[model samples]
Target: MKETDLAVGNTTVGLSRTLVWLMAIISGLVVANNYYNQPLLALIADELHVSESAAGKISVLTQIGYALGLLLIVPLGDKLLRKRLILIDLVLVIAALLWMTFARELWMLYVASLLIGATSVIPQLFVPIAAQLSNDQEKSTNIGLVMAGLLLGILLSRFFGGIVGDWWGWRSMFGIAAGIMVFVWFIIYKMLPEIHPNFKGSYKQLMLSVIELARTQPVLQLASFRGAMAFGSMSAVFTTLVFHMEQPPFQVGASVVGSFGLAGAVGALAAAKVGKLQTAIGTYRTILYSLLVLIGSWGFTYFAGETYWGLIIGIILLDLGVQGSHIINQTDYFTLKTDAVNRLNTVYMVSYFIGGSMGTWLASIAWQYAQWEGVCAVGATFGLLGLVAHLLLSRKIRLAAIKT
Candidate 1:
């Protein structure tokens, strides 16, 4: 075999069932680092003598850091040994988590949160690695499985953080996260076989290509927009949920609010199955149905303040819609340019998080002005906007194909 073929084949051969599971687990653990502070913001403010608004910036900064990492570090996956990059990032995550555990000042926490967010791009790296190892026929299936793990991590992090922070303090939560990272690092070092770089270019050239790919790829543009809208809407709901629950009808504590994540986890678990459906229905139809589900979620969530059951049902539908559409979007995007999977992912994710940040900001404003009704309206509007964008873009693409 040629050197490149040997490298690819060796990487594939190394991806045993157990190894895939390990990757999934590690991805979940790594990504969870970005979210551990969400449910602990109040606790953090009280303990650190910071304002609630200041404590909230920990989550915001973490997301900004994650976007930065997607732009700067994830693309390097295409140009370097992914195993080494993943391992190095895990070490950085552990160190950041440790710093977070011991942080006394708000500034110390903010800096650590940013570093943790930046290094937490390991899951993003692993998804493309999974794609590279699997053949085309199985690529979506494998990626779906890995992404399910990622979704679970995102949903469960709040639950874990809230419970642990409540029981043993917020610092203990970070200490536990650091311990998990150390274990994950060892597993990755031992189990993940090195995949050689596909792109042999300078760092500047690698960064430039990410811009070129975004500029040139229409499918990527549409997919990124769709993902951004879906995730942004989802973020709006989650970001404001704690405040909603603490109000009159519910009056729940952080731990109880955190348990809501379990409902969302049910939806994330279905992502692998959603991947199978994409083969039968195609991405466009799949996304259409997913958006419909998302709209339905907001409908139920609109009544969440009055009925707890509505929130439970809404959480399930919201997560299912988001995770299903996300899997399809990724599977489709990865097909556009195999060699640029990492960079393509970076573009898609950066847009996705930016949308999330906007959604969170918008939702906060909505809550302040009109409360739950406004938040639900905003969430549903995002879903509708995504559907409309997809319809228009698909029609344009079809017309262009016909003319050509």
Candidate 2:
């Protein structure tokens, strides 16, 4: 099972449609582990007798774990047998999900959340594998397809988490997630083609290369910063949304709160096609507009503190902006150096998740004091800062380009 299953002109290397779809789905489920707890935070806090703000740490811990994994584990993909890495990581994640399901104490649950975030980095492996499987002509489209699946999994995780938690218990959500991961793992083991490593150096050099790429690549920095801010803003909204709804005049259950992710799903679907959109308008403008859209989304969500319509509209726009910018960012960076995608992605994603953790942490604090208004302020501020960051980075890149 080499890359010969799908052929393009002069190249015999592209994934089959079935394999591409499988990669998308498996990657989606794997990434979903980090997010399943978002909608369950209120239930978890109630059961653990902790404050909702304390429970919010699960999201932050998970993102921290993910950032650590991106920094440490993902780079290994460039030096290891990717299929083996994926399976091994999946096994560890399944164990972590089980730990989360059976835990009796808050400390144990938080530990499990961290490990789940660490091991659930299999999707990052899959994305780079998808790029390796693709030929030059189809790379962006294939990457976008797998990315779309990952985004859908992320956007919809809350929806499913809310429903599962409401119907059974918060623990049941973890158990079900573990079960799904097992199913996907078996399928991937049976079907996914094994790709060879690209980097020729030892592990130490591979990590050093990640730093080298980060320093040399301004586009990498821009993409990473922009993604961090967009994801951070998005995180502030979802991390505390369950808390907001559970306590408010709305008083909606987890199920209803999760359903709002449907709006986000719509946005994710639209953003999945952003590869074409970037080509039409150029990456800078696409991302620039996306940042503005994210900033505007906070306005609706602010008023949404009072109305369902505002919440739904805000979610749609929020997701559309965040994911749209993300796809273009990946597309831009992937082209910078295709051979070292694993490391490139490692730098990009490590920064991205760190931003997410900060956003969740800040949103929790805002919820403690300013509540929804404070959360809205945090989200809008991140968006504005992201826009400013992008402008500065873009100008730097253009100036460097002229010199080169």
RMSD of each: 2.4, 3.2
Tens digit of per-residue lDDT, candidate 2, span 140-252 = 67888998899888988989999999999999999999999889888988987776676678888988989998998888898999999999999999999998898758898
Which segments of candidate 1 are over 4 A away from where they belong?
1-15, 49-51, 398-404
Winning model by lDDT: 2
lDDT accuracy of residue 217 in candidate 1 = 81
Query: What TM-score, to 2 decimals, does candidate 1 have?
Result: 0.94
lDDT by candidate, in order shown:
0.84, 0.86
Q: Count the backbone clashes (under 3 Å) in each candidate.
A: 0, 0
Q: Report the poorest 10 consecutive residues by lDDT, candidate 2.
A: 1-10
